[model samples]
Target: MTRIRLLTVAWLVLFPLAGLADYLEVRRETAVYKEPSKKSEKLVTVDPAERSPYLLKLASGAKTKGYYQVNLPGANEKGWIYQSYVRRYKGQHPGYVAYKRTFYKHWIDEDGDCQDTRQEVLIRDADAKVAYQDEDHCKVEASAWKDPYTGKTFTNPKDLDVDHVVPLKNAHESGAWTWSAERKKQYANYLQYEKHLLAVSASENRKKADKGPDRYMPPNAAYHCEYVRIWTKIKRDWELEMTEAEGEKVQQILENCN
Candidate 1:
């Protein structure tokens, strides 16, 4: 709670990681501008490479609206980079444990309409209309959903599992283990972004459990780029760190994207 400030607006997802970072890491191809604005002269590029993440140290805690005052990696001098282009970084975080029956993890019904996040995704992703468990449509029973992971179609809701594109376990290891329970709850049931959660085959989700693109990807080769893109976007948006292997894999796919 001390590190986070909640905004009063709707869709207020605070992007700060629960843990404090000792250094700043470039998220993508970031330019070190001579000043805080883009119109300022570009000093150099700070991009992540196979073995390097392009770390920066703060010259001072000075603020400039939407930029960080940091020292360029080797030059050790003041430069400015956009806030969104860099992420706070610490070293390796071990994230391989399986999930537990946590208090907040039960399917969330944010709208108090009884159709929990799971049901909502089922309904939203349906190729056509969906049936419900009750007259009020509180629970989705069946829907025609096309599984992007396997590129297969399923009509029964039981055949699908709503998946977190960046799996919870992976998130915990990356930076979310420090997240407040409420934040974890929000992420577990988040529906703000369509690609954040997907309705894919149950078996496909199980088979690809707790692994990154470096270790596993959707069986549908056609889905590789989209999968990587979603994975990268989710990681960047959440300010989560990718493991070396994971980072390399994502970078490779992104470099080849057309």
Candidate 2:
């Protein structure tokens, strides 16, 4: 049996095979974006080394500016991967590693109860019972959270972001790009490990976006040692690659810790 790798927009423009094929396959490492452009929020990357090539499906027959809407491999929602990255899977289609992953699973609703990972994190990190936005309790309206990165205490959920301690892009550069989509998702939303995701002020999180320890550190100097510890532990635990500079910086921070 032959696999139809992709039902890309270009293919549809030529063949127009609507509903004939549903699944999409990846040729190499590529990102599935939240929108049909490169600048949009990245959702995840599909890599050939991690799993089967059939990593996506046509979510709909939608097309826009050379992008095709596709269902993420391990998720229910749709994301966009560029048309050039996809091809009709006649058999043995080859592609280069045009993109390295900087995306990961967002706050997912693992139990499908409407509350997502973000809500769960907010609730857990809150010092008290969280207030809900609505009667259904689907959203957290208010919560007391201390932003370790900025040393500011916040009571509004909108003011905080559940930051990835090891930013997804940094993780990708640290060798997470080689992982399977499922593995990447697991790393992204992992909660078992302490401080993997921290509720920090949105401003600080933005300031720290995708930067490693060498480039970015918490503004709250008091949290510096703990920050380095968590960073190093995550790098060590995940077996992620580290630059010599990063290692040196981490060591410097650790030496000053009590």
Candidate 3:
């Protein structure tokens, strides 16, 4: 009777059609942790080779913030892994390689709404209703935005630059170089996460161009904590690597958050 019950349980875990969303295959060797945060204890490493780790996603929702609870194959262990590490398994390998800035092009109209990513960001982050030049609302003429990096406010949309918190070059050097071009485009124009992109003064954006926290921070010291926090979160979310000096500077700034 116990053997029958054990088999039933295994069947439910293996083929959870009722609650299952899909399966994700590990593309890279990544660690599953007891919690979603990297600060939490690591439970096990899920490698693409050997057993070739595949995770069964039991539900549509993440188990924790930014993590999915997955049933790891053959290990009889279940743990949370960052969603970024897993891609939906469809029998085709993604062929991930290291990111190069040349691999990516500037933002296009991904949603086909006629507005390109820059215009979309300008409209979305604007403090007031954005003024459009044409009838299609594709071209942004003006808007009010406060630049977090410089603590300066601007009324003209041309004065603001849509900045990638972790610049494309930095991302390429970190882990993004290994991602597909589609993924790189998504990262470049990511607006779903507020931390990923910002409308800042063009001068400030140029000052921070492609440099990490170690080399440059916002000129406004008052914005240091918030800037570092957003920068840290973006790097962590994307699983990007930070140099020792960059990491230390970010940590010091983060301490000021308290």
Candidate 4:
């Protein structure tokens, strides 16, 4: 088994492909897999104490969705590692703090579509025809969005904020503090589901900033059930924990949901 793994690693090293950039430090110890999928064979374990590994960005058969192709240290082995367990290393250690806006970078255009995650959400959730600022259709100039929290309507994009239903700080406190920087970015700019991010009135979002259901609920009582529903869903999707008060409040709100 070990000989076969060594042969595979040697093949990759002999014919290195292109687009291999970025060094990633293991935030937590995790296994290196023969393929990108977790169901694939596990070849080796990466420890946090070892020097950071290099992430191959675009090598042929190297990178896959949500995983990075890496060359392990002290061996000739190459395997795919889950991106969540590693961070792009810049000489800084991994750590997160509550309400730390500086730690997460939102509005990333991971798809290379010129339109960032923020603009994409604004365009998607708009109730009316969205106006584009440029020919590329990347920037959203104006749009009408209804705030679920305040029941307010705004035609200007500036009036609305793309709110993380489970705010960054809240997630950090719950369990994200242990996550790598890459994982935090994924949570902040998550576009997998509409409920994860919402277009809401800026003022209302500020009022509810980083507060869980225990301490805060939307001012628009009619939307309380939906708000809590989205909140609970986000927490569950990310495997976050809820405080006793938060759990009780969410349960109460759910009971009132029609």
Using TM-score as the measure, the top candidate is 1
- Cα lDDT of model 1 by residue, 1-258, tens digit: 112111211211121222233457666776777888999987776545421334555555656978888744323246787889877645332321334538238487898997889888888899988888899999887768999999999998888999999988877756555455677788888888899999999999999888988899899988999999888777755546565578677777777878
lDDT of each: 0.70, 0.69, 0.67, 0.69
Candidate no. 4 TM-score: 0.63
As a whole number from 0 to 100, the lDDT of residue 142 in candidate 4 is 88
Give candidate 3 misplaced runs (Cα > 4 Å).
1-100
Worst 10 residues of 4 by lDDT: 10-19
Name the regions of candidate 1 deviating beyond 4 angstroms: 1-104
How would you order the candidates by TM-score, starting with the best? 1, 3, 4, 2
Model 1 clash pairs are none
Error of 3 at 33 (Å): 9.7
The segments of candidate 4 whose C-alpha lies over 4 angstroms from its true place after superposition are 1-99
User: Candidate 2 — which residues are off by over 4 angstroms?
Assistant: 1-103
lDDT of 4 by residue, 1-258 (tens): 011123232211211211123346566778878888899988876565432232222223334888887754323356788878876543222432344776788879999999998898899899999899999999999878888899989988888899998888877766566567787888889888888999888988999888888899989999898888788767755545565578778877887778
lDDT per residue (tens digit) for residues 1-258 in model 2:
112233232101111121124445666678878889999987776666554443345666567988888754323356888877776443222421223444576778888878888887888889867899999899999878888888889998999998889888877655455466777878877878859888889988999988888899999999999998888777756645555567678878888999
Q: What lDDT tens digits, residue by residue, belong to model 3 across residues 82-113?
A: 87888765322344344456687667898899
Model 3 worst lDDT run, 10 consecutive residues: 1-10
